[model samples]
Target: MTPEPTLAALLARLDRVEAHQAVADLMSSYINACDLAKDIDRIVEHFTPDAVWEGVGRNIEFGTWQGREAIAANFRGVQERQPFTYHYLTNQEIRVADDALSATGRWLCFEPSTIREGTLPVWIGLAYDNTFVRDGDQWFISHLAVDTLFATPYDKGWGVEMFTPVTAPKEPSHA
Candidate 1:
């Protein structure tokens, strides 16, 4: 009979790889949360309690919130003010360090935030640079840094392509 791989051995093997799937999962949550554009709490569940989220749009926010609550509030502001636009994430890369518990990922994002009046209000090129940590058996976003690579005013008439709605995942029943 073959013996099972030891935890030490498994971790060592993982360290040699970039753990791209883990990074992809992180971005999946990001993309899913962005797509909802309604249920505001998804943003809170996506982040850890002390997560640091920043971007070109964080400041001059509609209002301020702190800790995980801050992220939820941010989502609220986002859904309330910004018209729904599809965000496309692509060209992602993850670099896993020798420490299996830590990793970093980079991805390019294109999205337009528009207003109800159909005015494209803001255009942004965002880079999601991440620091990850596993919470028990599950992975959660420990620290997220959003670098706005570029931003410009979206013309009033400009419209971006959007994917049609499918059955989106529901948030956990418990808050």
Candidate 2:
């Protein structure tokens, strides 16, 4: 017969389970903030003070943002370009550290976005790799990196093209 785990072992297992769920909840909250276009302050609360947000692969054009202030600015820019979007996250996997002070996670995101008011509708496929830190009892994002798999027009599938040209928003004319 298999031996039962000690109380200490059971407690440790519970801790890990809680940590995993906390990390997942944090990601969901972050995504919700983005989708809702919440205040920059609220959005940045999900990250550590010195957190880094960057883009890789086809998303390299997004550059990188370091620290909470920069991250907030980046999101502001995103809000301007992507006025409306629905982000769906799936295939999420999170692993908590043995000490339960940190965790790493990955997720696949599928987004349908309307760019620049009603100018264009696009479909975006992306992958996210995130690192999280536990402070006191709250978890914060330490680092977030995103890679774009595809960003194509809604009428055209990825099979037709991987990315659609995204131009900068035009300035209002005063005549």
TM-score each candidate.
0.68, 0.90
lDDT (tens digit, per residue) of candidate 2 on 21-106: 99999999999988875667888999999998877665434667889888887777778788888889999999999888999999
Across 32-113, the per-residue lDDT of candidate 1 in tens digits comes to 7777645567656766787765542332212223368666655655565565656788888887667656677778888775
The global Cα lDDT (0 to 1) of model 1 is 0.59
Clashing pairs for predicted structure model 2, backbone only: none
Kindly report which residue stretches of model 2 are placed more than 4 angstroms away from their true locations once superposed. Answer: 116-118, 167-175
Q: Which is the leading candidate under lDDT?
A: 2
Worst 10 residues of 1 by lDDT: 164-173
Error of 2 at 118 (Å): 4.7
- Give candidate 2's error at residue 20 in angstroms: 0.4
C-alpha positional error of residue 93 in candidate 2 after TM-score superposition, expressed in Å: 0.7
Candidate 1 wrongly placed segments (more than 4 Å): 1-11, 15-19, 56-66, 115-118, 153-175
The prediction achieving the highest TM-score against the true structure is 2
